[model samples]
Target: MKKINLENKTILVTGAAGFIGANLVLKLLHEVSRINIVGIDNMNDYYDVGIKEWRLEEIKTKADDNSTDSSWTFIKGDIADKEMVDKIFSQYHPDIVVNLAAQAGVRYSITNPDAYIHSNLIGFYNILEACRHSGDDSGKKVEHLVYASSSSVYGGNKKVPFSTDDKVDNPVSLYAATKKSNELMAHAYSKLYNIPSTGLRFFTVYGPAGRPDMAYFGFTNKLLKGETIKIFNYGNCRRDFTYIDDIVEGIYRVMQGAPDQKNGEDGLPIPPYAVYNIGGGRPENLLDFVDILQQELLNAGVLPKDYNFEAHKELVPMQSGDVPVTYADTTALERDYGYRPSVDLRTGLRNFAEWYKKFYID
Candidate 1:
C-alpha cells in the first residue's frame, strides 16, 4: 500500500450535501489542518432536500468552529456534467477524490432508471475521465480515487457473509448493476492510467441525520404519522446495519492508503485497484431491528411509552429489487485497515431517534 498524507492536500468530495459526504467533510475539517476540501452536489430531492441542506449547514458550522487551518468550497453541480467536472479538476487540482454522488435507493431505481444511468453511469464515467486527465501537462496526479459501491451488488446471494471475492454479476436492480459497473470501470481506469483507486462496498448504513428512505428512518416517520410500516419478506430479512460514523471512519482510513502501483512481467501497470466491504459483520433480523428501534424511539421521546407498536406494523412479501439479507464479510477491510464497524444497532437507532426529536418534533 502507498501511504498518502492528507495534511495540506486538496481533496474533492462529490455529494458534499449527502449524509455520508457532509459527515466526512466534517471529519476531515476536524482532524486535518491546512487542508483544502472541495465539494460538489446537485442537491436532488430523492428524499428531503431540507435534510441535505441541513447537512451542508452542519458542515458550514463545523468549518467555522474548527480551529484547524482548513478551507472548504462547495459547488452546486452534478458530476454527470462533463464540463463542470473538468472545470473542477482543472481548478482544484485535488490530490484525492471521493466520488459519492449517485442516485441511491433500490426501489426508486426500478421506477426511475434514467436517474440511475445519468448519475451512476455517466457521472462516474465523468469522474474517471477527469482522473485520467489529471496528470496531463506535468500537473500533480490524483494520488487516490475512492468511490462508493453498494452491498446491493451482492444481489440475492445465499452466502451468509458476502466476500469481495464473490461474483456479483447478478444484480437484481439497476442501482446494484450501476454500482457493479463502477467497480469494473474503476479497475479498467486504474489499469490503464495507474490512478490508484479503491472501491468500498458499503453495507446498510444508518444513523442520526441519515436518509429517510432507509427502513429505520422511514419506519419512524410512518409511525409518527400513525401509518402502517411494512415489514418486508414477512419480517425475515437480515441486514448488517453499519453506523454513519463507522462508515466515515472506514473511508478516512482507506483514503490515506492507495493500492500499490506495480509493474507486471510484461512491463505494464498492474492496476493499483482494490475493493473492500465496510460493514458490521453481524446481521440483525428485521423484526428484531424494528423492536429495538421502537424501544429507542420511546427512550428518545419520539414515541410514547404506551404506543401500540404491534398494531402499526404489517408483514408482507419482499418487494421487487429487494434482497432478503445483506451480510458483509469485512475480513479484508479489517486486515487491511485494522478497523471494523463497532456501533451496535440499538445504540445507532437511539442516536437517530434523539436527532429526530430535535430536528422534527422539537
Candidate 2:
C-alpha cells in the first residue's frame, strides 16, 4: 500500500454540491491544511436544487471559517461534456480525483435511462480519459482516482454480506449495471495506464442533509403531508443503513492509502486497483427502521407528539427494480483501512429528523 500525504496536494472532487461530496469537502477543509481543492457539479434538478445549493453554502461557510492555508474553488459544470472535463483536468492538474457526479436513484433510472447512460457511463469515461492523459505535458499524474459504486450491484443474490469477490454481473437495475460497469472500466484503465484507482460499493447511506430521494427523507416528507408511505416488499426488506459521516470517514481513510502497483510474473504491470464495500455491517429491518424514524421525528419535533403513524403507512409488494435486502461485507474495508461504519440507525435518523425540522418545519 502507498500512503498519500494530502497536505499541499491539489484534489478535484466531482459532484461537489452533493451530499457525500459536500461533506467530504468540509472534512478535507477541517482536517487537511495547505490543500487546494477544486469542485464541480452540474446542479441538476433531479432533486431539489435548493438542497445542493444549501450544501455548497455550508462548504463555503466552512472554508471561510477555517483560517488555515487551505483553498476551495467550485465550478458549475457537467462532466459529460468532454471539453469541460478536459479543461478542468488541464487547468487544475489535481493530484487526487474523486468522481461522485453520476446520476443516482435506482427507481429513477428505470424512467430515465438516458440520464444514467449520459452521466454514469459517458461522464465516467470522460473522467477516465482525462486521468489517462493527466501526466502528458504537465508531467504531474493523478495519484489516486476514487469513484462511487452502489450496493445495488449485488442484485438478487442471496448472500448475507456482499463481498468484493462476489459476482456482480447480474444487475437488477440500469443504475446497478452502470455502477458495475464503472468498476470494470476503472479496472481496465488501471491496467492500461497504471493509474491507482479504488471503487467503493456504498450501502444505503443516510443522514442529515441527505438526498431527498432516499426512503427516510421521502418518508418524512410524505408523513408531514399526511400522505401514506409505502413500505416495499411488504415490510420484508433489510438494509445496511450507513450514515453519511461514516461514509465520508471511510472515503477519507481510503484516499490516503491507495493500492500499490505491482509487476506480475509475466513481466506485465498489474493494475493498482481495488474495490470495497463501505457500509454498516448490521442490517436493520425496514419496519423497525421506520418505527425508529418516526420516534426520532417526534423527538425532534418534526412530527406531532400524538401523530398517528400506523395510519400513514401501507405495506406493498416490491417494485420492479427493487430488492428485498442489501447487506454489505465491509471486512475488506476494515482490514485495509482499519475502519468500519459505527453509527446506528436510530442515531442517524435522529440527526436527519432534527435537520428536517430545522430546514423545513422550523
Span of 10 residues, lowest total lDDT, candidate 1 = 134-143
For residues 269-334, write the lDDT of model 2, one tens digit per residue: 799999999999899999999999999999999989999998999999999888999888888888
Clashes of each: 0, 0
Best by lDDT: 1
What lDDT tens digits, residue by residue, belong to model 1 across residues 275-347? 9999989999999999999999999999988999989999999999999999999999989998778888888
Clash pairs detected, candidate 2: none
RMSD of 2: 0.7
TM-score for each prediction?
0.99, 0.99
Candidate 2 Cα deviation (angstroms), residue 314: 0.6
RMSD of 1: 0.7
Q: After superposing candidate 1, which stretches have Cα over 4 Å from the reference?
A: none
